[model samples]
Target: MDSATHQSLLNAARQVFEAKGFTRTTIADITREAGIGRATFYVYFASKEEVFAAPAHQVRDQLVAAQ
Candidate 1:
């Protein structure tokens, strides 16, 4: 997938995950937050859990870099 679209989804998922928490957030919630359809989300991610990891990894990297 292209970086821009991929980044958009990550950003959206991050917001939803933060606001709703992992257990409460759904793929539908992430897609809606990204302004993309459910099928489009599938093209990039196998599941909400997969997408959640991307942002979590990014956060970890950011924190590690700050130190």
Candidate 2:
């Protein structure tokens, strides 16, 4: 429930997503990179797409902020 753990997941997901692209990335891959359990991932996110949206929006937000 802490932001640290939530952000950890996001950071890990971003790394894996950038490396593998969305189609090739899996829940196991993200959890492994995040150093967390699958249940832990589910506790924060309902699905991979749900997790993906956050980072995607983050990227968008950064772009908007920079302009």
Candidate 3:
């Protein structure tokens, strides 16, 4: 999958995770929000936890670059 698609998944996951919390959120919830297939999510992320960390990692990397 492309970076745009991967980003979409992460965005969708962030929304769902915020709304439903980690325990309640499922892959289907994220996929539905992203308008993508469940399989597509797997192409970008191994699990919700990994996806959740992606944005944090991005920010951390940016901060490190700035420093």
Put down candidate 3 lDDT per residue, 1-67, tens digits, no spaces: 5589998998998899899998999999999999999998888899888988888898899999999
Model 1 compared with the native: what TM-score?
0.86
Tell me the spans in candidate 3 whose CA falls farther than 4 Å from its real position. 59-67
lDDT by residue (1-67, candidate 1, tens digit) is 6687788899999999889999999998988888998998988999988998887887899999999
- What's the ranking of the predictions by TM-score, best on top? 2, 1, 3
Clashes of 3: 0
Per-candidate TM-scores read 0.86, 0.90, 0.79
Worst 10 residues of 1 by lDDT: 1-10
The best candidate by lDDT is 2
Model 3 worst lDDT window (10 residues):
1-10
Q: Looking at model 2, which ten-residue stretch has the lowest summed lDDT?
A: 1-10
What clash count goes with each model?
0, 0, 0
Q: Candidate 1: where are CA atoms >4 Å away?
A: none
Q: Candidate 2: list runs displaced more than 4 Å.
A: none
Candidate 1 local lDDT, residue 16: 91
Which RMSD values do the candidates have, in order? Answer: 1.3, 1.3, 2.0
Candidate 2 TM-score versus the reference: 0.90
Give me the candidate number with maximum TM-score: 2
